[model samples]
Target: MSTLPVLNNADMYHHYSDVQFRDGCSVIHEMLKPKRGESILDLGCGTGRLTMQLASLVGDSGRVVGVDPDSCRIAVANEQLKKMDDIPVTFQLGSIREALPLGPFDGIFSNYVFHWFERAERAEMMHQMYDSLKPGGRLTFVLETNQPQPNAIIRDIFRLTEPNLDEESASGMKMDVPSVWLQHCSDAGFLVELSEVFRTEKAGPNLDAILQFLKASIPNFQPIKLTDDGLHELDSRYKTGNGDEVAFSLTVLKVLARKPQES
Candidate 1:
């Protein structure tokens, strides 16, 4: 996985992600409906926290394969997996954009990881996922929708600092709308089981907390290098100030689709 991209702050990513991924795990379990002895894939499994939970759900007879592009994250995940010798789970260090060999899987579940790719990479990713699944397998994932989504403080700051560039030309990965993602799944021969976009509110106590969270997120998704000046500028405009706290709301997109049985 030498060619795969990784965040410099892998430790920060692991610490910050434990909470965000925990909530997504419940949703994944509800939608994926994992059963014992089923072979499942956890796409972009990060430090393998959610993957372990999935392993527990599937039990001893089952197998869970967790894949992530970041070698740093995979190393940590392997370290953690070493202690859980009883579970039938393995961590693989590779990008989902790359070809995978261990499936014909019963199901595939990913949370908050698909928006990083550009159009062509995403096309390949969807195709690879379709190829990896069994005849009647399912895939469920949660990611932000394109446009009108929240957590744009950095984007806004970049605009203010360098006003010439447009949003499309901005240096970040693009997120697609729900319809586009559904269409991609359909094109890849998957049936749309559940598809919806909804809103959620998330907040931080102050500017420092918010910046810390963004620092953890931005590096993993895009190669943007945020500076102290950029942070100050973003905080000046984006954070809502009250007596002693600040907050914001974010729009989220969720989809759960499945591959139909081949006849």
Candidate 2:
């Protein structure tokens, strides 16, 4: 919520549509198989792609609330949902770390969002989520697992820009292992239901396509400060096996936990 660098609207819209949001929606839907007449909350629901899908899943008797920190993204999401009539949906501009307005939802879902918060803040956010859920309500989150290749790239970029990049540059919020996230959820009093790492590969036909993908999937790439030489270096490094495309594997951590019933 602080004055972080904002994403370019046009570029982000293109990137979101072309790369990130589609896959993210699929992952979230897979994790949350919503049923009819069930209340749902979408944490960090950028552009409302999943939120709208959730609305359809929940039907007229149910409600869906989407929350995000960026007002621009929320505005876009609202505009997208306006075309549809008579659907129960709400969008709020706020950080997930803070208290949420609506509570006791049947399910809480998020994708590619939690890694943005600091470790302690993430723990607190999990606690807030736990309190927001009804007894036996489900909480599921999909986040990037800290892997060697991505971490090396991130470190190199930060080191190139500024030798003494702080915790922000290091992305201290990202959980190094799946166990760490599961531990945090368990510590927050959630009954751990499922937790595991999933790996998938994405391919781009060219360097431009790869850059577009990164712009959408990697939030920090939005604020990149790269020298001309650095830019060229990156281009040279990311290439495909056939030497005609750019392909890379992304490692992810998927977790499903539930709020405990009181005695």
* Clash pairs for candidate 2: none
lDDT of 1 at 166: 65
Q: Tell me how candidate 2 scores on lDDT.
A: 0.70
Q: How much is the lDDT of residue 158 in candidate 2?
A: 51
What is the C-alpha lDDT profile of model 1 across 119-233, one tens digit per residue?
Answer: 7667667878888899888898877676574655545644644467664455354677778888888888889888777765555566555546556555533314456776666
Model 1: runs farther than 4 Å from truth? Answer: 1-5, 97-99, 149-154, 157-171, 220-246
Error of 2 at 168 (Å): 5.8
Candidate 2 displacement at residue 225 in angstroms: 5.0
